[model samples]
Target: MLLPFHRQQLLRITLVPLTLLLASVAIAQSAPSVIGTRAVLTTWSDPIEALGTLSADESVTLSATVTEIVADINFRDGEQVEEGQLLIRLEDGEEQAQLRASQALREERRNASNRASQLQERNLAARADVEDSQSRLRQADADIQAIEAQLANYQIKAPFSGRVGFRNISIGALVTPGMELVTLDKLDVMQLDFSVPEMYLGRLTPGLTLNTTTAAYFDEVFSGEIATLGTRIDPITRSVSVRAELDNADGRLRPGMLMEVTIQQRVRDTIVIPEAAIEPSGDRHFVMLIKQSDETTRLAQQEVEIGERRQGDVEIVEGLAAGDLVVFHGLQLARDGLAVRLIGIADDETDIRALLEADR
Candidate 1:
C-alpha cells in the first residue's frame, strides 16, 4: 500500500505550497480594514453653563401707618411713581379736625400767656400765674405738632421711584396700620442670583463678567457683572452664592424670570483629539497610529491622558503630540503591529505616501 519513492517525494513537495496558501488565506480573512484619522491641534475657549433667576434689586410693598378708612387712591395699578409722591390717602378727616382744634387752642394759649406776662409786668399777677400760662402755651404747641405728624401719616407716599403693583386696598375700605396698599419694584436695574460650586470660587470675583439669556427672550442676551459674593458657603451644597447686577433700563427683564448663565473659564493651550480617536480599555485609554509601505500598512498603539471635553473633542493633557495619526473608526479590528492595506485615499494626499514610495 506504500507509495513509490518518486511519488512520495512529489507529495511532500506539493504539501509545502498547499500549507503556505492556506496560511495566507487565513491571515487575510482574520484581519480587518479599519478607517482612521489624524488628531489635529487647536486652541479653544472653555465655558461653563449654569441656571439662574432674575429679581428686582430694589423692591418694596407700601402699607398704611395708621388705622383708618381709605379716603383716596391716588395711583392706578402699575403706575410709575417717584419718591415722596403721594400714592394713597386714608380717611384724614378726623385727623384734620383734630389738627384744627389743636391750632385754635395753641392761639388761645399764646394770647393767655401774653396777657399773663403784661399783668406780671404791672405787678397785678403773681409769678405762679405767669409760669402756668407759659406751661399751657408749650403744651398747646406740642399737641399741634403731634397732630400734624399723625395727619401726615394718613397720606402714604411712595418710598422710592418704581412701578406700583395691583392695588390691594380700595377707596372707602377700612385700613389698619401696617396694611399693604400696593407693591413697588425699581426695574431700572436687576439682580441675577445664582450659585456655583466651591471649586469655582477662585474664578468668580466681584468684577468678572458673564453672559445671560432668558427662556422668555431666547434670542436676546443680556450682560452682567458680578456685584456681590457671599461671605459664607452653603454647607449642604458646598456651593458659594453669587449675584450679578444687570441694567434693565428698557424694562425688558421682569422679576422671577428664569435665565441661563455662561461663564468662560481661563484658556490653556493643550493637545486635543477627536472623541472618536480614543479607545478605552478598563482604566487605560489608547489610540492607533498608521504607517504604510509600498505593498502593506502597519498599526501602532499609543497611550494618552485626556482632560476636559467639549462638544465632540477631548483635550489631551499628556502622552500625545500634534502630529500623531489616530484611528477614528473600526478600532475594535485593530491589533498591535499588524500589517494593513488601505482601500481608499490616494498616495498624493496621504502622510504615508512619501514613506511608502521611499520604501518601494
Candidate 2:
C-alpha cells in the first residue's frame, strides 16, 4: 500500500484539473454568439422629402384676340407646332379686297407723281404740283400698310414651338377676344415645384440635385437640378417654395402631376454602422462594440451621437471611429463586459432587410 501523504498529493492533483475543467465549461456557457460588422467610412446624406407638382417648362393657353368667324383650322388637335406657324384663319375677304384697292391706288398715285416730276423738270409744271403729287402717293402707301396691319389681326399663329392641346372650337365657330382655343406646352423639359420647411432655407441654393417620383410612373425616377427658389417664405406655413427642372425627352411626365421629391442637402464622408447595431434607451443611444482583450472578445457599451438615420444605416457623428467592429445581431444577448464569440462577420453586400427578417 502507498503512504497517506502520497495519496493526499494524488487527490490534490486530480481535484485541481477538475476545478479548471468546471471553470472552462462555465465560461463557454456564459459567452454569447453574435454577428458583427465593421464601421466603415461612407458618404452619407440628409435627405429632404416633400410633395411636389410637375409643370411644363413653358406653358400657355392660346386664345383669340378679336371676335370673328373661324374660316379654316390649319392645325389638327394635339398637333406639335413651330413658332409662327399658322393655327387658324379668320374671314379676311373684306380686308383683302381693301388691301388690294389701296395697293392699286398707291400704284396710280406713284405714276402720277412720276409724270408730275417729269413735267417740273421740263419747266411745264410748278414745284408745288410735283410736291402735291408726291404727298398723295405717300398717303396711298400708308393706307395700304394700315390695311395690312388690320388684316394680320384676323389670323392666329403659334407664339412658340410646343405640343398643342385639343381645340375647343371647330371651323366656322365665332371666337371672341381672350377666348380659349387650346393649350400649348413645351414638354421637352419639366419643372417641379415644391415647398420645404423654412428651417431648410439656409440650405437652399441653385444647382442642388433632386430626385422625383410620381404615382403614374412608380418605377421611374426623374432627376433634376434646382432652378429657382421663392424670394419670400410663408409665415403661416413656415415654408419656402423651390423649383427644379428635369429633362423630359421621353414625354412621360405631364403637367400638374403630383410628384414625390427628395433632395439630398448635405453629404459627407463619415463613420456609418448598421442601424441594428444601435440600441436606443430613453434619449441616449448605445452600441455594443466588440473589443479584444487577452485573446478573447468582449462587449464594450459605447454611447454615440448620431447625425442621420437613412435606410438601414446610421451616421455616427461622435464616439465612434472607422474600422471599429460593432455587434449587429443578438443584441439582446450582449451585455457590457461579457465575453462574446464572433459567429461571423456580416457580408457587406448582404441586404439589410434580410438580416432584419432573420433577426425577427
By TM-score, the best candidate is: 2
RMSD, each candidate, Å? 8.7, 3.2
**Regions of candidate 2 where Cα sits further than 4 Å from its true position:** 1-3, 279-285, 292-295, 343-360
lDDT of 2 at 38: 92
The candidate that achieves the highest lDDT relative to the unseen native structure = 2
User: What lDDT does model 2 reach?
Assistant: 0.90
Minimal lDDT window, size 10, model 2: 351-360
lDDT at 63 for candidate 2? 84
lDDT of 1 at 230: 94
Evaluate residue 287 in candidate 2 and report its C-alpha lDDT on the 0 to 100 scale.
98
lDDT of 1 by residue, 123-197 (tens): 999999999999999999999999988888988888889998899877889988777779999999999999888
Q: List model 2 lDDT by residue over 1-360, tens digit each.
A: 666998989999999999998998889767777889899998878888999998999999988777889998888877889999988888989999999999999999999999999999999999999999999999998999898889888988888898999989988898899999888999999999999999998997999998999989899888999999999999999999999999999887899999999998777899999898999999999999999777689999999998888788889999899999999988998999889877667866867566555643
Lowest lDDT 10-residue stretch of candidate 1: 340-349
